[model samples]
Target: MVCAAMLILDVLSPLLLLSILLPSYGCRAADIPEDATSEFSVRLYHQLQAAGEQDNIIFSPLSVAMALGMVELGARGASLEEIRQVVGFSHLLPGVEFSLLQNLTAALSDDDSHYVIRFANSLFLQEGVTFNPEFLHLVRKYFQADVETVDFSESAAVAEQINNWVENHTESKIRELLSAEDFTSATRLTLVNAVYFRGSWKNQFRPENTRTFSFSRDDGSEVQTLMMYQQGDFYYGEFSDGSQEAGGVYQVLEMPYEGEDMSMMIVLPRQEVPLASLEPIIKAPLLEEWANNVKRQKVEVYLPRFKVEQKIDLKSILQDLGIKHVFTSNADLSAMTDGKDLYIEKAVQKSYLEVTEEGAEGAVGSGMIALTRTLVLYPQVMADHPFFFVIRNRRTGSILFMGRVMTPEVIEPNDHDFDSM
Candidate 1:
C-alpha cells in the first residue's frame, strides 16, 4: 500500500510497465480533498496515504511492476469504479509483488462468456506475466469449461501444471489451493488471487514463549489460535467501535518483517470477526490510530495460523448486489464495450489466506466470464446468515465481484468463488 499506490493510480490504466522506482512516490497536492467527495474514493485515497505516510522514502521499480500488469489486464471495458476498486484493493498487500499479483484477473477479456477462456489464457502469455510461469496456453484451454458439466479429467492435468507453476513461482508460498478437480462443467472460471505476506512486527515477537489463545465465537463456541506476543516497542491500537454501527470490537496490530522494517504485518481484528462486516472498519483514521497509539506492554497475543478459502457463485450474487441493470442481455454496456453486444455472464473469486505469527501468507485470485452477481440488498442484518463480501477499492468503488457462502464447510471451490477482494 505504500508508495506502490502511485504506480497503480497512474500506470495501470495506461497499460504502462514500470521497471524502476521513483525517488519519492504517492499522491501529491492534486490528489487531496477540500470537502465531501466520493465516499469510496475518499476513503481509499486516505487509506493509501495513511499506509504510505509512515514511510516517506523512495520506491523500487518492482513495487509497481505487478500493478502495472494488473492495470494492463483490467483496463479494457473496466469502469472507473472497477479500476478504482482494483487499485484500492491492491493496496492491501504488504509486498510489492503480491499486491501486483492480486490483480491478475484484471487482464481478463471483456468478451462474452464464450471468450473468457481464450482471453484469460492469452493474458498469461502477455509480456510480463512472469519470468517463469506454467504453460499458460495449455492451462487456459483446459479450464475453458462448459455449462453442461465438464469432464475435467483432461483439464485436471492443466490445473496440476498451473498449480505447480504457481507454487514454484511463489516459492511454495501458495499451495494446493487451485486444482483440476475444482474446474466445473460451468463456463469459464473467473477469479482473483492475493498472496504472500511475509512481514515481521515492527518489533519481533519471541517464538519460544508463544502461547495458546482461547478464541470465542459469536455463538460462544471456542477454539484455540496460537498467539505470537512480544512486549516492547510496536505499532498498535484499537478500532474503538464496530463497523456500520454494528457494535463490534477490534484491535489493530502491526508486525514488521524482520529484514524489512518498512514492510509490516497488519492484523485488523484482535479477535475473530466476520470479514464481510469488518470490511467497513478498515479506514485511514483507524490505521492512523494504530500507528500513533500503540504502547509497549507485556501482552499475551494469540492468533491462529489458519487459512480461509472461499469460492463464490457470482452470477446471482451480482444481480443481488444492486447492479441489476447491466446483466440483462438487452442492457447497455456502451460505457464499457464500444458498440458491441456484451453482458456479464459469470464472475467468480478465489482467495486463500494463511495467518500466523510470521505474518500473513495468502493469495486472492479472481476471474470472470461474461457473468456478474445478483443480490436482494434487503435491510436484513448480515450477521444471521452467510452473505457475500467485497472490498470495493475506494478509488473506483467497483464491487470487485461478489461473494456468498451459505455454508463454508460445504462450499464447492469449483462451482463458486467467494474469493474475497
Candidate 2:
C-alpha cells in the first residue's frame, strides 16, 4: 500500500480560486455544527498570516476541511486522531465529520437559483492496487466521490487528465492545476475535491459609478485602481478590542450576495492605521461577535475591484498544526488497505480570487454617494487601504474563502481618469 499521494482541492466563486491534494490508506457520519469548524478556519488563517507576511491571501477553509475529511476516511490511529483534533471534530463520534462535511457542502450547493455552487470529489488509484471495499463504499456514500484507476507511471498523461477534470468542474476558471512533476511511478492514490460558486450581489454595483481611485498599500506605496462606489442598506458595525491596541476603532461591513445565504464580510481599519496592527486581534470568537453585532443601515461604500492568488505548501502548514503522522513513515492507514507501508507524500493548496463590479443582473443600487473627504453623512466603508475579508455561508457559518487584500487591482498612471476623480 506504500505510494506517493497528491490531493487537490479547488474553489471558485465571485471572489475565487483554491486547490489542495492529500492521500492515505480506510473507511467511516452527522450535521456539522455551525462554528464547529471555525477553530480550524481561524487557525489556518493565522498560519497563513505568519507565512504570507503582507502578500494577499486567499483559500477556502471549507474546501480544505472536506479534502481532509476524505483523507480521514482512510486514516486510522494517530493519523486519524491528528486530523480530528486539528479540524475540531474530536468532540464528534468517530465518523460524524464525513456526514457533516456532506451536509454543509450540500446546503451550500442545494439552492442554485441564487448562486452557482458545485462540488466534485474523486479518487484516482494506480491500476492493479487492491484497496479495501469498505473504504471505497464509504467514500462514495458520504462524499459521492467518483473512483478511477490510472497508471501513475505515465506521469504526464495522469497530470493532464487530472488537470482537465479540474478545469471542467471549475467552469474553466482554474487550469493547469497539476504538473507531471507532481506525479511519479511511486504514486498510489490522489484525492481531488473541487468547489465552484458564482453569485450576484443583492444590490449590484452600477458599473458607471466605478472610477479610478488611489489605493494605499501597507508598505507605504500607492496604486491607482477601479473603485466601485454605492450607497445602500447593509450590515455594518464598528468595534474595538476595548484597548488602544488593534488601532483604536475598526469597521465591519457585511455585503450579501443575491440569496443572502452567502456574504463577503470586510474588516477595515482606520486610514491612518495599518492592517498589521489589527491582524493580531482576530480570533474565532471575534469573527462570531462581529457577525452577530452588525446592524442593517444605509452606508456609503468605495470598494476596489481586486484579485489575489497564492500557492501554499500544505505539508509545512499541516506539520506546523500537529498533523505529522500521515506524512511520516510511521503512518497508520491500515483501515484503508491491509498494508503498513501507506502514507501521504506531499500536500499543497493554491487559491485565486477576483472581486469585480458585477453583481445580480436586474438588481439596482440605491444611489451613488459623492466622493468627499470631510463629509461623514453615513457610516462609510472606504476600502482604500489594506483589509481582511471572509466569504462564507451565512446559515452554516462555513468559510468558503478567507484572506486579506493589501494591493488591489493596480493600474498604470495613464490608466487613471483625473477628471472622474
Candidate 3:
C-alpha cells in the first residue's frame, strides 16, 4: 500500500468547508446488513472528530487527500470490497483514505449511508476493465474515476517514478516513505507513496530565543525540553477531573500549512505533567468542553519543542486493535460490487513524524500579521514508542484508512506490508 498523502486535521465545524462543498450525491444502498450504513457514518464522524482532539506537532492534510487518491486507485480495479474494508479500518490509522471516505459518505441519507460509499469507486480508472453498469452508475453519481495508463520500459522504473511523484507531492513530508527494499519485498505488485507537508504557525517562533522547560514523562521524570512560546487567539479551556492533584487547562496550538487550507491543532495539558499521563483526559468530549469553555486569556504558555519519528508494520496491530472482521475472507462488501469474490490481500500502515523548535524564527507580541513563518529544523512528536495516528478529512464521515505502529523496526528494513512476521 502507498504511504499516506497529505492530511489536514481540521477542527472547523460539522458544516466544515469541505462538507459544505460536497453535498449529498445519492447512491443507492444495497440491502444487506442492518445498521451497516449508520455504523459506517458514525465511525467516520468519530474518527475525524478524534483526530481533531489529538496533540499534533506534525500536520498532514493526508486523510482526505489520500482517500481521494485511493478512491482514484480503485479505478485500477483494486477490489471493491477490499476498498470498503480498507476505508473502514482507516479511522484506526487515520490515513488519507479515511479522511476522503468521510467526505464521500456524508451525502448518503442516514439509512442509505452504505449506498453512498458504493459509488466511491467511480472516481478512478480500472486498468483495462470498465465497471459494470450497476457499479458504474454509482461511480457516475458520486465520483468520476478517470485514470490514464502510463507506460514505462521497466516495471521497477515505473514504480520508482511513482515513488518520486509521491515524494514530491508530499513536499517531502516523506522523502522515502518507501525505499529500495520496497521494490524487492512484495509478492504482489506493490505501490508506495507519501504525502509530505510543512507549515509554520502564521505566527512563528525564534529558536535562539528558546528557554529550557521541564517536560514530564509518564514515569514522572521531568526532562528539560525547550518550550516554544507564542500567544494567539487559542481554543483555550480547562478541565478538573484527573488523577494528578493538578487541575489544568487545555491550551490549543494551531499551526497552518504553507499552501493548504489545513492546519495541525495540538492540545497541551496546562500542567507540569507528562503528556502521556493525560491520555484518559484526552477525548472528543474533552475538546468539546475545552473549545466551549476556556476563557480567552493572555496566559503564559510553556511547551517543549521536540521531534519524534516512528515507523511500524500496522497489519497485525490493526486486527488486534478492533478491526478484525473486515480484513478476514468473510468480509462482505457487496456495496462496492454486487458481491464479488474480491478479497483484501493486505492492509498495512506506516507513518513518520518529527517535532522540533530548532531554527525556528517568528514573533509573538500578542498581535496578528501574515508573513510570520518559522522553519524548525528539528520537529514533531517523537515516535520512539507507541502513539496514535490518523488520516482525517476536514469534513464528512468515512474512514478511508487506519493503522497503528507499535515498532518502527518493522518498517526500517523496508519490508513491504505482506512480509510481516
TM-score: which candidate is best?
Answer: 2
Candidate 1 C-alpha lDDT tens digits along 159-238: 56545544543445445645544443321212222222123333444545343333344343544333344344444454
The per-model lDDT (C-alpha) reads 0.30, 0.74, 0.33
What's the true lDDT of residue 76 in model 3? Answer: 26
- The alpha-carbon root-mean-square deviation between model 1 and the true structure, to one decimal in Å, is 17.0
Best by lDDT: 2
Per-residue CA lDDT of model 3 for 184-295, tens digit only, reads 2112122222322232333345544444433444444334434455544433344566456333433443333222122334454444444444445544444344334545
TM-score of 3: 0.51
Better of 1 and 3 by lDDT: 3
**Per-residue lDDT of 285-345 in model 2, one digit per residue for the tens?**
8988999999999999999877777777777788899899887777787777787677776
Better of 2 and 3 by lDDT: 2
Model 3 ranges off by over 4 Å: 1-155, 179-198, 211-214, 220-225, 231-233, 242-265, 269-272, 320-322, 332-341, 354-421
My TM-score estimates for the predictions, one after another, are 0.43, 0.90, 0.51
- The window of 10 residues in a row where model 1 has the poorest summed lDDT is 3-12
lDDT, residue 55, model 2: 91
Error of 3 at 418 (Å): 43
